[model samples]
Target chain A: MTRDSTPGSLRVLVAKVGLDGHDRGVKVVARLLRDAGIEVIYTGLFQTPETVAAAAVDEDVDVVGLSMLSGAHMTLAPLVVKAIRDRGSDIPVVLGGIVPSQDVEELAAGGIAAVLGPGAPADQVVEVVRKVAASRS
Target chain B: MIPRHNGGVNSPRQQWQKAFDESRLREGPFQTLSGIPLEPVYGPDDGEYPGQYPYARGPYASMYRSKLWTMRMFAGFGTAIDTNRRFKEIIKAGGDGLSTAFDMPTLLGLDSDDPMALGEVGRCGVAIDTLADMRDLFADIDLGRITTSMTINSPAAVMLAMFVAQAETAGVPRANLGGTLQNDILKEYQAQKEFVFPPRQSMRLVRDTVAFTAAEMPRWHSISISGYHIREAGSTAAEELAFTLANGFAYVELARQAGLPVDSFAPRLSFFFNAHIDFFEEIAKYRAARRIWARWLKDRYGATSERSMQLRFHTQTAGVSLTAQQPEVNIVRTAIEALAGVLGGTQSLHTNSMDEALALPTEKAARIALRTQQVIAYETNVAHVADPLGGSHFVEALTDEMERRAEEIFAKIDEMGRGSILEGCITGIEENWFQGRIADSAYELEQNFNRGERIVVGVNRFLEGNDDDDLAILKITNEDEAKQKQRLSKVRSDRNDAAVRDALDRLAKDAVDSEVNLMPALIDASLAYVTVGEMMNTMAGVFGRHVEVPTI
Candidate 1:
C-alpha cells in the first residue's frame, strides 16, 4: 500500500486486461466499489498487463482487480502479477468473472488475493476488496 | 356422454356465468410471478392474421406446422480440426444448422501467432488464420447442403471469403452455398467491442460483403443484424429491439447509398435476437421487431417485395442469464427461454449449455442443451400453433407497448443523425450514447439483484444445498495454440510469398477506392493463402485502426 493512502480511504483499480470485451460485469463492479465510498480507477477494455500494472503504480492504488471472462485467467492473471512485481509493487491483485472452480486454488496460490465468481453479491465483492486492501496496509 | 343443452331454456351467457360461479379454482393469486395480472379467459382483440403486412402475428402462415425451427447449436473451440469433429457430431445428432464461434483473436483480425493473441487463442472459440484452416473447419461437411452461420465480425470479410474459397475448392459453386454471415459492425462499437478499422471504413467492408452476396450467392444471408450482444451487454428488452432494428435500418440505408436495390438485398438481411428471461417480454419484443421492420421497409425504404418486408430472425437463449451456482438449473432456464423463442415465431433457435457461466460446455452438457430445443420441438404442443399467444390481451398489449417504446428510441436515434438512421448510428457510436445507455441498464439490474428486488435462483435466494463443485467443465489446453501456430507457419512457408504479397496489395488498392467492391480481391487473397492478419493489416494500412474511447 502507498504511504499516503489512509486506512478508511482506500483506492482500487479495476481493469479488463486482454482481448475480452465482456465489460458488463467489470463495469458494474466498478460502480459497486465506487458507491461503497472507495475511489475506483477503471482502466477500460483491451488493456495489456504492463499498462495495467503501470497505471496501478502511477495511481498508487491499494488494490487491483482484473476481470477475465475469456477463459484466459490461468495464463493472463500470472502475467499481470509478474508485471506488477517487475514494477516493484506488491499491490494485492483480485480476479473476477467466470473463473472455474479448479483454477481458483491455482490463482490464489499464484498471488491473486481473491477470485470472485459470477454469483458474487455486491457486498461480498466490496468486503473482499476491503479485506485485501486492509491486509496490505 | 350424449347430454345436450336446452336450446331455449337458458341463454349461453347465463349458463357460462352459472358454471363460473360453481366451479372451484386453484388457490388464490392466479397471476404471473412477475405480478402481471391474468384473466381466466381472453377474447381476440385485433383480427390480424399471419403472413400479412406488418406481421405482428407471425411471419409465415403455417409457422411450425409447415417447418419446425432449425435447431442450430453454436460450437467452436481449440483448433479448426477440433471444431470440425464437433460439427460432424452435431450433424449426426440431427442438428439442422451450424453456427460457428470464432476465437477472440480471429474476431479481432489477429492471427494465432500475434503477441496480442497470446493465451487467448482457441480459448473461447476456434482459431482460423487462412484458407487451409477454413478447409479443416468444414472437413467432411457438405457446404452446399447444410447452412452455416459464422458468428464473426470485423474480419468477417476474410472469414466469408475463406468460406467461399473453401467451397470452391470442394467443387461446390459459390451460388450453391447456403449460410449467414454475422457481419454486423455497428453493434461492435456499441456492445461487443471486437472492432478493427474505423466505423466508416468498417461499413465499407460490410457494404462490399452485402453487394458480393446479393450478386453471387442467391441463398446466402448477407448480414444477421444482431441484438443478442446488445441485450447481453445489459440493455433492456425494448432497447435491444430498438437498437437492433435501428442498426438493421442503418445497413439498409448503407446498401441503398451504394446503389443496391432495396428488394435485391433486403430479403436476405436477417436478424439475430437474444431470448432472455421474462418470457412474455421476450415474445412481445420479437413480435414488435417484426412489425417495426415490416412497416419501415415498406413505408420508409419503399420496398415492393413482401420478402423484403418480412422480418425473419434466429434466437439464442441468453448466455448472460446463466448462473454459475446450481449450474444444473440452467437447463430449466434454457428450456423456458427456448420455449419463449418458439412462441415468438423464431425461424431458428440455440439453447445455451448449463456450464457456460463457468466454461465452455462439455460434450454431455452440449447434448443436453440440444435436447432442450428438441424437447420444445417434439414434446411440447407449443409448436402446434403459430404465435399461439397472439390473441391474449396481456401479450397483445405488451407487444404494443414494446413497439411504442422502440419507436421512441428510433426517433431519438433519428434526431441524432438529423433524420438519417445511418448517420445517426455513426454519430451515436462516436458519442458513446448507446454504450452509456446499456451500461446504465446493466448497473441498474445489478443493483436490483444486489438489493434482492430480483431473485436469481441459487444466487441471491435459495442459497442452501447448492454445490457446483461436482459439475464438470470443459478445458482448452494450451497445446491447441502451439498446433495452430505450427499450422500457420507451415501455410506461410508453403504458399508462394510473391502471390500472397500481390493479392494483399490488390486488396489494399481496392480498399482505397470506395467504388470498388473488395470481395473479389479478398477472395483472391484467401486463395493465395494470405492470412486474416496479413489481409487486415494491409487494409488497416489504408483505412487505419479504430481505437475506441472507453465509456466507463
Candidate 2:
C-alpha cells in the first residue's frame, strides 16, 4: 500500500460486475496495475453495480475498471456508470473484457472513459489508467 | 570443433550433450510449461501400452480407428426457443452430440426473472427457469437418440431433475436418457467461482446427486470431473491434470463413504479437459490423465472392473488462447488444438468459435469452428491411428513427467487435509490454496507474454492493423431479456402455487437429512413447475449460501 511519488500514481477499483464468474483477465489487469506502482482495490467476483459504485466512492479511487467476459457487458456496464453518476461521483469508468469493437461507441456513449479489449498489453492498460486518472485529478 | 555431433556414433545421451555444448544452447534453458527439462530421446520403459491395466498410451485399445470421436459442439445462447433452433442447426451441420451451456443465472441457481439475473437472462447461454424451458431446449432433438451434455454446476441437480421430468413428459424412458452433467463443484470453489453453497454442504448435495443418478440413470454420467476451467483459469497442463483427477478421487471417496460401490458409479464418471495451444504438452496431459486415473482407481479405490478404471474425457479448445485483435487467426488456433485433442484420444470434442474472444460466436463463426473438427476427422487421416505419437520420445517422456508432477501436487493437497483428497480440497478451497496457485500461474503467463518470452501471433508479435470491427458478434438485447422474463412470469402465474410450495417444503426437509437423497423431491418440485430459484432457495434454507474467503 506504499504510495509512489508519481503524481499520476492512480488508485483504481477493479471489479467484476454481475454474475459473470470469469475473473482471470481482471486479476491479471489488477496485477499489472499494481506492478506499475498503482493502488488497486479489487472487489471480488459476483458484485452488483450498487456495491461497485459504493466501493468506488468509499475507496476514493480515481477510476473504476469493470471487467466482464459474459456478454452481459452491454447490460452490466451502463448500470455501473449510471450508479457512479447517481452516487454524485464523476470518477471516470474504464471497461475491459471480451467487448466487440462495434459496441465501443455505445459503451462510450454511456460515459465509459475507455474500452480495453482482450490482448491489450499491460503497458497499454497502465497507460490508459494513468491517462484516465490524470484527467480526474 | 563441433565434435562431429551429427555424425557421432556415440551413445544418444553423450552425442546429445556434445551437440548441446558445441551449439552454445546453454544461453537459455528449454523447458515445458510444467518446468520439465526437454530431453533428447526417451527409452522403451518411458510409458505403458494402451488399454493396459494402468493405461498410459490411451484408455482404449482401438481408439479412433474403431470409431471417430463425437463432435459435441457446445452451443446455447438466448431463450430456449432460440437455442432449440441452434441445436437443430448444429445437428444438421454434422454435429453428433449436443453440449448445453446455460446462462449465468441458470448456472447460479437463479430464475431468469430474478433481480440478480436482470441483465444476464439468455445472454451467455440458454436460460432455463422451469421444466418448460428444458422441454423447449430439447424440442426437436430426441433424448433417446442424441447424447446431450449439459455444462452446469451448483444447480446441476435442479437441471438434471428438470431434464428427467421433461423426459417423462416426452415419453422417453428413464434408462434411455444419456448425457453428462458438469456437476464438479470442487473446481467451482477452486477456479470457476460459480458456487452457491459452502464446500461441506455442497459435497453433500453432490453426493446425493451421484448416489441418485447411479441408482436410476445407468447411462447418464453423474459428473464430468473437469480440468478445462482450471486450464482456462491459467493453470499449467500438469496442474490441471493433478487438480481435476484429485477432485475426481475426492468424489469417489465421498460416494464410497455413502456406501456406493466404486464400480457401480465409477464407470459412469467422465472427465472434461482443455486442449491448449501447446500441442505435445496437451497430448501428453490426456495420456497422463488416463494413466494416473486408472492406477488410482484400481490400486487406491480397489476397483475391479476395467470400465471403472478407464478414464474417458471430453476436450474443448482453449478459449483463453483466442485473441480479439485478429479473431480470424483463432480458427487456426482452434484447428491445432482440436487436432491435439483427437491425437490425444478425446472421446468427444468441442471447438471454440473464432469470435469468442470478442463475443459469443456468430452463426458463421460457430459453423467454422465445427467444421474445424470435421476437417480433422475426415481429411487429416490423424484419427485412423490410435495414440499416433505414442512411441515418440518427446511425447512419452513428457507424459511420464506430467504424471510425476501431478502426483507431487496430489501429495501436497493430501498433506493439507491429513491424507484425505476430499477434506484437503475443501481446506484448499477455504484457504485459497488452489486459487492462489491459479492466480500465480495466470500472472506468470501474462508476464511472459508481456516480456516477449512467449509470442501470441496477433497479440504480441504480429503487428497487424486492428481487424476487430470485421467480426459480427452476437448481441443479446434488452428485448431478449424482457421476453425471457415474460415467459417466466407466465409460468409462475400458470402453475399451481400450493403444489410448488409443498414440493419445495419436502425438498428442504430432504436436504437437511444427510442420509436422505434429494433427487425424488427435486423431481417432484420440477414436475410442479417450481423455478430453479425456488428449489435452490429451499435448499439454501437448510444449507446456507457460500461466501468465499478472499485469497487476493
Tens-place lDDT per residue, model 2, A1-137, is 11223355668889988998887888888888888888887888888999999999987889899998888887789899999999999999999988888889999998999999889998999999889888875
Model 1 spans with C-alpha error above 4 angstroms: A1-8, B1-46
| lDDT for residue B198 in candidate 1, whole number 0-100 | 97
Q: How good is chain A of candidate 2, measured by TM-score?
A: 0.92
Model 2, runs deviating above 4 Å: A1-9, B1-48
Per-prediction TM-score to the true structure, in the order listed: 0.93, 0.92
TM-score of 2: 0.92
Error of 2 at A16 (Å): 0.9
CAPRI quality band, candidate 2:
acceptable
Interface RMSD, one decimal, each candidate: 3.7, 2.8
lDDT of each: 0.90, 0.87
- Indicate the worst ten consecutive residues by lDDT in candidate 2 chain B: B23-32
| Residue pairs with backbone atoms closer than 3 Å in model 2 (clashes) | none
